[model samples]
Target: MSEGDRDHSTGSGRLVTGAAWAALLLGLWLWGTEVTDVRHGLSVPATGDMAAVGRPAAAELPPAAAPLKDARPRRIDIPSLRVQAPVMPRGLDDRGGIDPPPYARSGVVGWYAAGARPGAAGAALFVGHVDTEDRPAVFHGLGAMRTGETVRVFRDDGTVAEFTVDDVQVVGRDRFDARQAYGVRQSGRAELRLITCGGTFDRASGTYTANVIVSAYLTGTGP
Candidate 1:
């Protein structure tokens, strides 16, 4: 080949290689930035739908030998997870939908009143923010929970309901399946669904791409 043609070919190869390296570097930077944002809880979604296994049928719980309305959850404790917080009656806000509070100091442990009660026949729904304004909040360490861990719910009626973790899974926020998270259920047993934000974060939108849900079932109860 002529000297001029050889020189041109070599220059083009270098240009292509440099462009490829630049693209790779850009992708790594974006990925790292996303991870940082998620760790800080800056871009995670503020709300998510609970997924369940099956739809619960409408049936009255067996009459307690004693009335136990006073036994509703008042505080939640997970010793292995180092979580201890008072339960609040977190119902629908003015928007008429279930959403976790934006602030950590809200001190609200939300409950899906539309779902079943603890120790009832259906899955009881609970949602909380992992963090807010970069401050750790309730359920912050929820992602670290493993199967067999115990979650204690202290009912107002002085009864403590204990639940054993069954599984934890992460699903995309846009693909969150509420029925699979909060509706499906088995017979004669109460279930629990806990949700928080996780997965990749998007700095442009300031939210995570997915949510982490932890499922559990009633193991027993005590005073």
Candidate 2:
């Protein structure tokens, strides 16, 4: 195998550490900022500018909707990707990284229980696996989602928060910015972030080279 090819492996295993997501967890602690940066909205980086990777030139997104009361998420649906999955609360692991759903539950998505609740006035974070040992996972097609799409989060209060896709990025390991990636894009707006492993898998490192981040803002609501 060539130099880069040497990193190729035959099977997919539980690969979580070395992920750029750790930066997000660390950022939360060091920045002393709320999960959504209550003071202000975090802007996207200009240097790597991965925000519009899958956005269409003519996509016209809707304006942000009024923030809603806090409610725990029960499920998530991405109509475009045909992704409908359960949302389970997850906390940090011993290593301080997000302890996502177990590998066996790849179809389930994990929500940061301690952070902003979905439909609330903050950034609600959802994470899932891209793939497993022999099958594609819940977020396998996440990177293909484009701007102007929609993500629906069903809340325990019997309402659905409808979000409009505004940013989709494939942030590489070297350029991962926790604040920019996970921080709220607009103050007072209910935001959502769906994250998963992306880019080429490195067998040698047992991790992916990047993370696919899908950013959306609440634009409407439903019963």
TM-score of each: 0.64, 0.82
- lDDT string, candidate 1, 1-223, tens digits: 2344335545221111111111111111221111211121111222222322232322322222211232366778888667887765555444344545435343456665545566555566676666554455677677666567788888766788778776566666555544444443444456677766666544444455666767777877788
Candidate 2 lDDT over 109-170, as tens digits, reads: 99988888888887888989888767788888888777788999999999999999887777
Among these predicted structures, which one has the highest lDDT?
Answer: 2
Identify the leading candidate in terms of TM-score: 2
Tell me the lDDT of candidate 1: 0.52
Compared with the true structure, all predictions reach lDDT values of 0.52, 0.74
Q: State candidate 2's TM-score.
A: 0.82
What's the CA error at residue 203 for candidate 2, in Å?
Answer: 0.8
lDDT of 2 at 223: 98
User: What would you estimate as the lDDT of candidate 2?
Assistant: 0.74
lDDT of model 2, residue 142 = 86
Stretches off by above 4 angstroms in model 1 are 1-70, 94-96, 102-107
